[model samples]
Target: MARIKNGILGGVQGCIGDVEGFIRNGEAFIRKRKKKSTVPRSVKQLANMQKMSVIGEMIHSMTSFVALGFELISKNQSFSANNAAKSYQLKHSLQGQYPNLNIDYAQVRLSEGQLPVAVNPIVNLMDNGVQFSWEIDADQSYDRATPRVMLLVYAPALKKSYYTLSGARKNAGTDFMELPDSFKGHELHAYISFITDDKNEISNSAYVGSIGPAFIEGRNEAEDSFKAQNDDHKDVLTTKSIEHKDLLIPAIITIDDIKPEKVVHTKPNDRFDKRAKAVMKRIKK
Candidate 1:
């Protein structure tokens, strides 16, 4: 493929007899038109196509969450964020065989990184919304406490998701995502991950538990992590509840817009809270 230059022809997006011009991710390009293949697809080839179709369909709806999860890996590697996400799902999340293929939600990972993941992660449904919590270590010698949480909840029946990109600090141990009215009486699968306060890194997500009416499945005894902490610790943690009610939004991507678009933050320091900045400063000391 060749890029359309800034000239008389400028850019094109259609076939002009012998040449085919197109725009991908807003970049214009041209290539020679080729005749359609006349050969039949082999069994193996057809199976691969089916796999890509199913996986691509699932990835199409959650590009926003995928962008945050795969941002670091995508930037460091050759693949784009959406492509990197699809590649991982294709290799790991699909279940059954070709004709009977499906996505195993339990195995689905929204984000991947070298950062340490949440220990003993859990999720609970409350009157306000679904709250996600994780065990916080007291050790503060490392760069572990300040990364914000990424709460992801998928409703299998709805084929859509509700999530937040930047949430409470890991040390805060908990965050809430307000659900839409449509989520009433529906089951949801929850996953939690972490992204650096600077947005430079992320952590692999953990499937906390599956939610149902008054019950949780897949978790040994999934309850709000808040219930297990010391009463004194609760006092400190409760004070750290940072409201991101606005960021708790749903995602639905169009089929044509297949590429993952990067979400650019205005300025890192502007988003950092005073408390987190103080904690980081003290930890670095």
Candidate 2:
């Protein structure tokens, strides 16, 4: 009986040793596989790429949400919707291309008649010498290819007065009519109309009242100096306020001035001075 028990014990010990060895070998194999997997540069790059892609998707989602929110807010507020949406789309697209891009306010304020107030007017204004600009979020994410800017001008006096000056097509911000040379001496009333890229649009004509011919109010220094040097120069130095008679009147002819019964006086070239007609033609072409 004692000998049989000893043999059984030996068999059991052997089996336990075998099992321990198998476990050690399995652990080593697993460690080796893990090391091999991580050591390959390509594998590491692929992992990083996946991580970036995921981050980009997250960013895109977040930007899209924000853009939607902006649209809603714009609907309620006086903000430009088209510009806002364009900016949002631009940012998301850029983020997809480069994960770290960000967006912030990059708006350019433009008055009805004057140069755009923010940034360099020359660069911000369109090539046509018009005052037009876009309000953008300064996010590096905004697409460089498709900037958000659109403007329209409505002139009542021109034969064809409604013109769309879309920034997407061409730079037309600087294309405003040169203050008419004939208006150089007078205070002219100009009605300017505009709409932003975002459906946040408005078309009430802005009346720019009385822009005058360029003039200097101060006395002539040259004449004053000459007067100081000569006794007779006093007569020459007598400064008179030179009023430009042309500028004294309203730039646009009033309806009251037109005799209701009389045939409306139309110039042979009735459209010669019509800037709106010119703009409309250019847009159509």
Candidate 3:
């Protein structure tokens, strides 16, 4: 009986050990599966973060573009009118040298007291090539004797590089620059400086912006038409002046129906005839 009791206790102990081992194995398997599941979740979270970052960048870029467009359009009308007036004045001043000369002018207006000059949404093409136009208020009182205007253009792709020039004029602007054929897709920027005869000046060197590829649809047709008219005027001057010299030269000699020589002569063919003959002879010689 004692042996049988001992055998039963031992069997019970072995069964408990076997159950505990099975429980331990099951726990380990569950832990391994949990870890495996978490790896995919981690990868998914990382992917989501990357996508959000890309979206944020895109939104930022688009917002900048929209803002720039709005600013350009809003100030364009007034700026263009002002520039046209100034150009008219300049042309009027230069009329003696260039009788048939005129300027086809437009302006890119900025917001009241903006840093950079306003950029035209459309690209401007001139005789030289494509360029931009903007209005700049003179910083200091320009001297009538030696007024000075300064213009700066920045090439966006080449970093902060710029082109600068100085001249005499209170409200002078720029024509388009000749761009290389390979520079079709590049960007450009513009700034303004005004210097007075006293050497006092203002420089807004921080003014910076960007340009883009020229769109065929955005060409300034009105400006182009104005240029065409001016060109036609030039062509007329070149071609028609030789045939119409009488229209160009004023009549210096006026002839009256009554001959002055005949009426004023006291002695008919006396000294007057001799003087007239001598003058004629001198003229012929």
Candidate 4:
């Protein structure tokens, strides 16, 4: 609303259409309004929104660790660590179409820096916990040993993840992430990285292999579908209104819906085929 201070042609006091009015040094001034795009969102824009939604939700589950993981990378930047990592994941980690996107856990990175990454990383399921071990690089410097291992374990079905910002030292060669009793029967994905003791520097996270079943999300739903078809002759079928006994009416269909002639081909979903084969090799005894 722009109010005319004087009769008809004086100073404007508020906003009008694409401009705003203000009084500076007792002088009336108007500023042009910033324009907003009125066009419909493009296909790519919608796809990015879907990606952001999926990644944002997952990252929120482990925000504390994620924030610290990219702390240094986000230093002095406009965005926070969480957004930095999210931006990175949005570009490289997500897979599949708009509504059916999934995170490529193997390519997902928690931290980024110049420090050395975990080498020969291995994960194993044992005693209600997952063990993380890596071949430590032979850099005996204090900086190398000062870097501690950071670990993450994610349970997709549960949509919950647990991580250690600072766990075992890089030289420890092994670390264990104890899972709660609830994690026992679930499939898991693990990632590992290294951060300095002072949390100043970090290494790129490595995919520490997955254990348990390579369960496909949402596959647990009932494979077979049932559609009930029933027809009625309206209210005229009632005993009181049965004057049209000569008329043909549809019979109420009560069927089990299973066809004896129909055959369902159960395609093998064995660890997503050859991909799971390679992941299986990463499993250490």
lDDT-wise, the better of 1 and 2 is: 1
Worst 10 residues of 1 by lDDT: 244-253
Global CA lDDT of candidate 2, please?
0.32
lDDT by residue for model 2 (18-114), tens: 1321122112111121224546456557655654454343234233223332444455454443445444434332332233443221221112222
In model 3, the worst 10-residue window by lDDT is: 25-34
| Candidate lDDT values, in order | 0.73, 0.32, 0.36, 0.74
Candidates 1 and 3, the one with greater lDDT: 1
Task: State which candidate, 2 or 4, has the greater TM-score.
Answer: 4
* Each candidate: RMSD: 23.1, 28.4, 27.1, 21.1
Q: Quote the RMSD, in angstroms, for model 1.
A: 23.1
Clashing pairs in 4: none
Q: Which candidate achieves the best TM-score against the true structure?
A: 1
Clashing residue pairs in candidate 1 are none
Give the per-residue lDDT of model 3 (tens digit) for 1-285: 112223543222112321321122112111121223444456556554444443333223223222222333334343332333233234332221222332111222111222232333233644334554445445633343233434433343433323334443544444444544444445555434334444433222223344444334434778788667656544444322222233322321112222333333244457655665654564467
By TM-score: ranked, best first:
1, 4, 3, 2
Q: Per-residue alpha-carbon lDDT of model 1 for 135-247, expressed as tens digits?
A: 98998545788888998877766777788988998899998889876666677888899888788878998889888652233333333443344333334432122222112
Clash totals in order: 0, 20, 0, 0
After superposition, candidate 2 runs with Cα above 4 Å error: 1-129, 158-164, 168-285
